[model samples]
Target: MSKIFLALFVIILVVFFILNINFPLKKHEIYGKYVNRNFDKPICCVEAPHTEDTLILYEDKTFESKFYGAGTYILYNGINPEIELFYKDFNHSSSAIYKTYFLNGIFEKPKIMLNADMNHYYEKLD
Candidate 1:
């Protein structure tokens, strides 16, 4: 009887191990948490017309930009190649306001076409 009990226990343990391996634990994939805002570098728009426009990015996935006013930003990057930015008044409402932009360019400096205006280009400050 004892030998039979030991065999059953071993079989149960094997079954549990197999089941656990087949159904892996679900976990959040923290890999590549920040796609764009992972660095401490600041990207700015140095155009004299909008010299005050600056974007300071942090590793914490948060940003502070001064375009017309000071604001906070949340960056979103999933499986898609494009990164989405959500902005809010850091001193005002907590909700972010939507804007239009098709961001592109080199890593050091990024270019954005605002409201589909391809004529004017914004560059990052060194």
Candidate 2:
């Protein structure tokens, strides 16, 4: 009976190890720096001010933005995966606001679109 129990335990451990190796937890695919694609800038001007609005998403589920301020974000996974940003403050002013934006394109380089509008979107920076 002791030998049988030991064999069963070893088999279970091996199965668990194999499953863990084959299927791991999915990492956040949207963690990266994204810049507003519509920001106008001079192409020929090397000294042009870098005033493009930027959004930075951290691995810890926190995000910082030039327009929306710093706060935590939730990524809703589905057929139409969306990201909800809870703004803590903006421009030193305190206000509680949350905005939902749709994600488009591939996982490697996604465009965060406003209200499903493709024209108004932030492209992930490589």
Candidate 3:
């Protein structure tokens, strides 16, 4: 009876390991609505135009942006985490890559900066 119990335990452990390998868990903090408020200012320069764009990140690893349209996102975890956006209708081509960072060391106030331009960024809306 003891041997049978040990064998069952081993089988359960193997199944759990396989499941984790096949589907890894993802971070949930990055999912939210981010907006660029600089465009709302009346006194806007050539670099920052007068426009309002909002980015919504879903828990399913998908995102929708006013300017970028709808697409799926992949988060690369490391020292500096990065998000890669791929447009759904663009044959899975990469549209943009954003580097995530916290503002004033506040985790709740996270911001995603565009890799192409440091000044261009989206702050999480509380």
State every prediction's TM-score relative to the real structure. Answer: 0.36, 0.57, 0.54
State each model's CA lDDT, in order.
0.39, 0.63, 0.61
Top-down lDDT ranking? 2, 3, 1
| True lDDT of residue 84, candidate 2 | 75
lDDT of 2 by residue, 57-89 (tens): 898988887677678888776656667777755
Instruction: Provide C-alpha RMSD values for all models, in order.
Output: 16.4, 13.6, 13.6
Highest lDDT: give the candidate number: 2
Candidate 3 has an lDDT of: 0.61
Error of 1 at 87 (Å): 3.7
Residue-pair clashes per candidate: 0, 0, 0
Pick by lDDT: 2 or 3, better one:
2
Which structure among the candidates has the greatest TM-score?
2
lDDT of 3 by residue, 24-109 (tens): 22366567998875554444233222467888989898889856678788787554556777663333454444334423222235
Candidate 1 residue-wise lDDT at 52: 34
